[model samples]
Target: MFCFQCEQTAHVNGQAGCASTKGVCGKDETTADLQDLLIYQLKGIGQLSERLRALGKPDQAADSFTLYALFTTLTNVNFNRAVFTGLIAEAARIRDRLRDALAAAGGDVSGLSAAVSFQPATDLPGLLAQANIASVRAGLDLVGEDVIGLRALILYGLKGVAAYAHHAEVLGEARDEIYAGVAHALAFLATDPDDINALLAEALALGRLNFTVMEVLDAANTGRFGAPVPTQVLTTPVAGKAILVSGHDLRDLHNILEATKDKGINVYTHGEMLPAHGYPKLHAYPHLVGNYGTAWQNQQQEFAAFPGPIVMTSNCLIEPQPAYRNRIFTAGPVGWPGIRHIQNDDYAQVIQAAQAMPGFAEAAPAKTIQVGFARETVLGAAETVINAVKSGDIRHFFLIGGCDGAAPGRNYYTDFADHAPKDTMLLTLGCGKYRFNMHDHGEVAGLPRLLDVGQCNDTYSAIQIATALANAFGCGVNDLPLTLVVSWFEQKAAAVLLTLLALGVRNVRLGPSLPAFLTPTLLNVLVEKFGVQPITTAEADIQAALTRQAA
Candidate 1:
């Protein structure tokens, strides 16, 4: 098994990807093969779903399941081999279901490839034997590195798209086009086309598709919880029986809050869930106290120290350490073999565990940080922002954010944010902000020098703010006085980058290192075509952005 669909993939002798028994994410070869098989099966399901849709007999249930199944394959989301084994069978059943409908609808399924024709095995060894059907690195010698790299990018982007769509879907949002787009892209993958130009177009199309998915997710979030407002979140803990909610699922956090209400339990947000505090409906829960930890990578130490139960709601989970493994709970797509999982939004076990353990022993003073500078809050102050720029009070903007990792060079983001000019505003989101978010940036023209846009899930908010500012300044988004310094770790970041490229937003400096899946040739194409460049030094990149602004 070979897997390099993330920023943290193993590098052996300068060759990227983890081809050993285990991946850098701790996903063993068995798990990796199962994920590959699940994706392969999803491709078949998608092929049939696409064909059925074209015949005007779309399967909505299969579409929803497709989104959820694709999401489970995302990096750090699921590592349970049993879960993957089950999903493989479920995917096959769904594919067959779609095929039956297509057959009835007179949609020809003849002459299709194995992805659409092969049967899944009943046992683990049998399934593993068929892993070749969905090998990520197969035929690299024939198709070459660039083609394989492009295909991985598209497939990973689909994972990100599915994750976002699934979150929104669970929050009561759905679109037929989403189903069609996902199915179409998956079907496209099944053909294994090596045409570079066609593959690039499909990648960009997936990016555009993600833009709509992001919109639906944004609407789902704001509609259910009200638009995020700028609010101060306390970083210190309070005295009570406590439960820490991590990852990006607000729905899980909300349910935890409700179940623990008046039960002597205080809920704290961690990782990407930090932005949940800014939502009116969620913040209204007084028991939902401050944040407990910094980012996902720090969870081993943090979770070990936390006294109460910890619930992981979505992605960004690392292998649970023995110190806190028993106390930790996985929900939604999150899973670890022996760890208890909370299903169906039921928080009884979580609440009971929180009640059973010791929480924070003492209440600390509110050490607050500003959050929720989303599209609404940012655009509401557009007049002030515009005036600040016109009056030379704000020189530029730097969006220094994305998933943070334990890798060495992550300091680039912190340094980039720290070394940014005082006149420039720093816009951040996701766990990457934890690097320098606590720094006092002072105020630029009555606005804080740093603004927290939100979680990575709220990337739509960042894009919206950029578009609004561009429109206000009467220029293309590329022409705006802004720089995007993105630190990506997983597939969601891949999707975000694709969305930016598809929107034609240029000069995004991505680091801590380029994706291993990207062969040098593919990286060159991105650099030449999209102005994508790897991060150099903070001071140097900062000077470069300023120079571009001056020119």
Candidate 2:
């Protein structure tokens, strides 16, 4: 159980990784090993599926399975071993079917690696037995740390891509090109390439692929929910039977809202779902109440105190404590060992749980928070923003966005946003904004000082807004008075960072700690090539960004 794919991995002496019996996220050794086995089998499916696609016989089931399976392996998404067991067997079956299809199509399949040809174990013991060789560290002695690190980067980025693509797929949006790119990237990792240069190129390629996935996701979200508009959401509780929906899946939230409509349940957004309030269709629900909590890391306490059922729709779920475990339900790719899972968009069980629990006794004092400042919303006011910048009323723009974690260093983002000068505009996205989104940033030149672009995947929106701003000023994006201060926690943030680098977007500050997988040499390469800087104190970084803009 060697897992170092997240920011909060345990650091022992000079080494960084979660090699103990349980990970920092509460994932046990058994679950971690099962996840590895699932990924290994999925890579086999990827190899066969890529070949099958090349033969003009693409399997939609294989493509969908790869997305869902890869999504489950992301940080804080799923911890149920039984779920992985089923996925492993299914992946093996899919791989065999694809192999047969490829062979029948006259595609040569004999030279494929063991990942495409190996048989999956039938039971738990056999699966555990196969894990040692299938794990990420299998060839560490021969390939070395730098090669292993690069492969992990590409693989982790692909996992992030799969998560975003799955969100888009559930919304009835998917591109064959994105699917093929995901499969090809997974299959490439299976070959265990040792060339550092080739691996780095592949990582950047994944960044480009992830950009497409995010674009598709943006389309799916806006197409289904309508473009986000600036709206004020209540932060206080509403009186009624209530259910809290967390995670990043708008489709699941939509389904839950539909199922619970007029049924007396007041739905409240939690975590990344906070941004859903800005969407016209979602906000139209009369019973869709205000946001209920902060970021995912605070779930244990928040969920325990809430007097209603809670439904997690995607990643960033910690192991449920017993206090609220029975009332908690997992949906989509999220799962816990004993927590009830909502399948096929059927949230009947969740509704039943909500009905059984005592909701808010009475409406808490109404308070509001503003959301829905995505690219369209921001660009709609482009003239005002441009004028403000030109008149020097808005001196700079700071983009403080990314995934949030429990680490103390994350407070730097809060302080940075809170302390930004009144003349500058603060832009935020992702769950990281939970740290300071609630804080008042006062207006700068008639516009809200703090603007939320959207979810982590909506880094696409941030990119678009920056590009638009650059075009408005007739300068490159890097030449604008915009700075990106990213707080990374998981693979999704890693993929976003890679995209920024791939696009030649420079002078970005990344932190809450660097990825444990990146060796010193690789880190140096990023520092030199992309001008990526480790975050300093909030005051120091803010001053530095302002200094760079002035220069």
Error of 1 at 503 (Å): 0.5
- The whole-model C-alpha lDDT of candidate 1 against the native structure comes to 0.91
Model 2: per-residue Cα lDDT over 1-551, one tens digit each: 99999998899999999998999988999999989988887777878888888888889989999999999999999999999999888888888888888888999787577888778778898888888877887799998999989998888888899999999999999999998998899889888889988998998988898889899999999999999999999999988899999999999899999999889999999999999999999999999989999999999999999989999999999989999988999998999998898878888888898999889999978899999999989999999999999999999999999989998789898899988999999999999999999888889899999998888978889999999999999999999999999999998888888788888899999998999999999899999989999999999999998898888
Note each model's CA RMSD in angstroms.
0.9, 0.9
lDDT of 1 at 108: 88
lDDT of candidate 1 over 63-122, digit per residue (tens): 998998888889899899999999888888888888888888888888566788779899
Query: What is the overall TM-score of model 1 with all chains considered together?
Result: 0.99
Q: Over all chains combined, what TM-score does candidate 2 have?
A: 0.99
